[model samples]
Target: MVGMTEINVREFRDYAAGLAQQAASLILTKRAEITATDDIRSHSQTKTSAVDPVTEVDTAAEAFIVDSIHRDRPDDGIIGEEGADIPSKSGVSWVIDPIDGTVNFMYGLGEYAVSIGAMVDGQYVAGVVINVVKQTLYSAAVGHGATVTYRDGTSTILRCRQETDPQLSLIATGFGYTQTRRSGQAKILQEVLPQVRDIRRMGSAALDMCRVAEGTVDAYYEHGVKIWDVAAGIVIAREAGAQVRVPEVWEKNSARGTLVWAASAELAPAFERLLSSVGANGEID
Candidate 1:
């Protein structure tokens, strides 16, 4: 029987890593099955939506992961995108987004991911984000460095972009749940477009943050992102030498929205300025 003492950070990391790998394999196989036969009956049957674009894959993946964790660490709590909310103010809590890019998944685009993060007393200690289609895993622990392992078994250390000039930096952003929410996002984009090198609207927030960690992008910011959406990615980005801050640090009541800024310290100020100029209520300046 697994006990609390046996469920250390290392053990949880290894266990989650294994499960993520297995889930990735399953996703690939399922995708291939749909592609080869052109029969999506199985896939269609499992397609359920909590919101318009969110689907059963999200719930299934979350349930599979939460169940695995509970089997070994029943005392630990879970906060998942699909399951009932479990209070996370005490002990160990795992935050999960089974499939981070639901729209991409529904459209047969292979850009979604599985995100998991473990926190102790509201502070993230370890996290992992797996790009199932790419068979890549990004992982980090509080004191340990961030690393990305590819399907070829090669692992590389990740670091955030150091580009100081906003005109030369590549930025990533995402829209919120509602059309009105997107209006605020569009306003921020319009403000930043002329200043930044380019903007990418990647569907998956987790993947967008991983891209920041991998140095493929300079930074990522989004509004209305849930705790699960950014929790794991935040750890990965910070471990990769990126500066991460919630909105509250720069303004009062900023935590009410999902605002994350990730970039090298050299460029964080400029990015923050842009965010402040366009973010809701312009509170970051």
Candidate 2:
């Protein structure tokens, strides 16, 4: 494994800040065309089974990003959602969720995105999530703060809502892979709905978390998210003054787990209590 490298946070931020912009531009330029969709679809060798849906765009984007990282920071390792997990040579690993909300993308919903996060010695250091269709970029670095930039070159600091009333908070959540998982998620929703202002199912975990980070939504909780799905958003959310946690603590296997993000620390307890009441264990595997 790569030992941690001491690098200036500003340098890291500058390197990653433009990533979402570039990705967004590329995706937008290619959208709504058969060749583009076919190119994206062809990447999936596996049939759209009930278990997983892999697309051509996912693989291509991962390859594109991995190559970019290797060229820019040759010492860093990469853990992509669709590719092999390689150990880091520089104590910093780049996590990639190349095309999140793939189902939406395949169906032309345009809600899918590219998410990238850098983890140093297993700790999230920086991340970027780009809404491909909207050309919106959300990025953050530890101690450097978080920002959202639009296609027009306008930017603003992201700040999560500090609402303390659960009954007034707008919550967001997602369904997992299996029916059993769905049932458990439903149970949690049942418990939390009456207590919160309302709930939304946006189908894109990365974008949903960004909404929370930007205060467009008050909180977000989901079961069984991969590291790539949340890694970058976690950094952005936390930097935007949101409270985040992997629902439970364990001696090992902390990298993959259920996650909760809320506007305030005080709101997390209520959400966790709801999950506990539903017999939901915050484990992802």
TM-score of 2: 0.86
- Per-model TM-score on C-alpha atoms: 0.85, 0.86
Give lDDT tens digits, candidate 1, residues 3-76. Answer: 23434656656666787777667666666656687633345433222333555556667777877877877777
**Window of ten residues with lowest summed lDDT in model 2:** 247-256
How much RMSD separates candidate 2 from the native structure? 3.4
Worst 10 residues of 1 by lDDT: 247-256
Tell me the lDDT of candidate 2. 0.74
